[model samples]
Target: MANGVMIFMALYPLRYLKTKVDRLGKADLVYLLTTSVISIAVTAAVVVTLQNGITTYLLAGVASLAVWMSTAWWVGRSRTDAPGTRER
Candidate 1:
């Protein structure tokens, strides 16, 4: 569970940063810190609620990765389709 939560903590910043960069062209440190803190709090609540075994922990990480990737893909797609946004 802890490992899963840690993975969540680590992976979110990349997506958040990417999204911010796509929209703003630069990553804000305050935004990064705030999101990281929020992610930690939410993950802690989830970990406490689940209270399961190692398999659950691993599964949590996998699930989080999937969600993050899908969200990133969606955001990227939307940006490409938006007016004035060019595809690289």
Candidate 2:
């Protein structure tokens, strides 16, 4: 859950930078770092609550990736359909 939230939070500014600057700059790095820290904290909390060892971590990773991809797809579709937005 925390990993998903961190990635979701990071995605907006990263996408914005990609569109406006054509490259990731310093702000993007900061966003990534922040996301990493948040994700680590969340993952730690989850690990403490689970008893299945590596399987729990694997499941969490898979779920987080799914959430990230779904959110990215939704955001990409919305942006493309908006007036004056360019298709990628």
Candidate 3:
């Protein structure tokens, strides 16, 4: 069931991106691809861990969750940084 749901969500994005292909820059493309994989993996891992009481899956979920959030933050930070601005 989880696999089916995740698969549908993954494929649905392709349909949505069909008309937006030309509008998305390379960075946007990379961010989207990275986030999609991380989101799916993390979501499934957390769900499975909860449903099965498995510590192994819990570790996987925590690790991926950190990665998912950090990626989002990094992308957002990059987008907001100006050409001449330097954070000290």
What is every candidate's alpha-carbon RMSD to the true fold? 6.4, 8.2, 6.6
Displacement of residue 34 (Cα, Å) in model 1 is 10
Put down candidate 3 lDDT per residue, 1-84, tens digits, no spaces: 445656764564455443433222223445656766877777776776666655645565566557655765555446534233
Worst 10 residues of 2 by lDDT: 20-29
Expressed as tens digits, the lDDT of each residue in 1-88 for candidate 2 is 5456555554644554444322222223344445444545555556667858678777666654555444444444445443446768
Candidate 1 wrongly placed segments (more than 4 Å): 1-46, 81-88
Q: lDDT per prediction?
A: 0.54, 0.50, 0.56
Write one digit per residue (lDDT tens) for candidate 1, span 24-82. Answer: 23334444445455555555555677878776566555655455444444444555554
Cα error, residue 45 of model 2, in Å, equals 8.1
Q: Any residue pairs clashing in model 1, and if so which?
A: none
Q: Judging by lDDT against the true structure, name the best candidate.
A: 3
Q: Name the better of 2 and 3 by lDDT.
A: 3
